[model samples]
Target: MDAMMMDAMSKDMMSMPGMESMDMDAMQACMDACSACEQACTVCSTQMMDCAPACMNCADMCNTMMRSMMRMQGMTPAAMMAMLDACIAMCQVCMDMCMAHADESPVCKMCAQACQACMDACMAMKATMATA
Candidate 1:
């Protein structure tokens, strides 16, 4: 992350009531991964591959997940959990679709990798929430 982003995230984190004690590093990492995945999925989806639907869905879910993190003040724990579930589902769909065409397109392979990483990050966030 850049200094400006870290600073902004720090300010946002400081304002959240109980979020001060949360793992800021993990959250930032997940957000970064989501942003990267969203970009890759968007570009890959434009290729008109069979994975287009899942890629579009993944892009949307990643945007939602990133925006929710950016605006944490609007989220309750239940809402956050629901979002995580949705993101994970989207990632699974995208990954499955991309994997099917991995042999035909390098973009699909890369997109699948991004989706897998995003799924892992979302799962980590979900685990953290469960412990909280």
Candidate 2:
């Protein structure tokens, strides 16, 4: 998202109960990671590998997670936490599936890296939300 957009979101989100003090920096990083993971997974899914199914699923999950983050109005902290947890879990599964054959496929390696980054970002977001 853009700075102007985030600024607008910040103004709107400040009135939300649990998200009143959300860390926009962490949110931005998580969104960026989710987008990268989604792209990587979409590319990896087209490789006709055994991990393709997991890659596709992860891509969808990442997209949903990013979208949810971008649209936080009426969203509860618990719901956001759940979404983060789901995103992290999906990323983990995809990473594991891709890592199994990563040595033989550069795309799998790239996808695995993106999944790991996404997982890390989600975890960070979760932690920040918990403290927010």
Candidate 3:
């Protein structure tokens, strides 16, 4: 079902410049990772840890990134690339902050893991776009 949705999305994006060769798989993975990261960060933020601010910021960034990916009708490759870079940077900061207390906080550990996955997915999406 998701594959079919992606196929429909890919077709919709075919008319956009630089989107003809965009990999829908990478887009889906990135969106999924962003959503997961956002949820994880929101949960971790409630733990009242030092990483709370970073977690909040990361969650917002992930939400924006995921939304941008979903609504790419007017999005340019360059703009999407910039958003990916910002998401990657935010995830890195949040991950570092979470990792600092991962040994003591399970939520932090989970958030860190999610952040890493989001970073990897965004990077993959960036690579796919770069070659397009």
Per-residue lDDT value at 105 in model 2:
100
Residue pairs of candidate 1 with colliding backbone atoms: none
Arrange candidates by lDDT, highest first: which order? 2, 3, 1
Residues 57-120 of candidate 3 have per-residue lDDT tens digits of 9999999999888777778888988899999999999999999999999899999999999999
Separately for all candidates shown, the number of backbone clashes (residues 3 or more apart, or on different chains) is 0, 0, 0
C-alpha TM-scores of all predictions: 0.90, 0.92, 0.92
In model 2, the worst 10-residue window by lDDT is 10-19
The C-alpha local distance difference test score for the whole of candidate 1 amounts to 0.84
Each model's lDDT: 0.84, 0.90, 0.90
**How does model 3 fare in lDDT?**
0.90
Candidate 3 regions exceeding 4 Å error are 7-10
Q: 29-121 in candidate 1: lDDT tens per residue?
A: 778889989998999999998899889989989998988887777777778788988998999999999999999999999999999999899
lDDT of 2 at 92: 95
Worst lDDT 10-window in candidate 1: 14-23
Q: Cα deviation of 110 in candidate 3 (Å)?
A: 0.5
Tell me the lDDT of model 3 at 53.
98
Q: Candidate 1 versus the native: TM-score?
A: 0.90
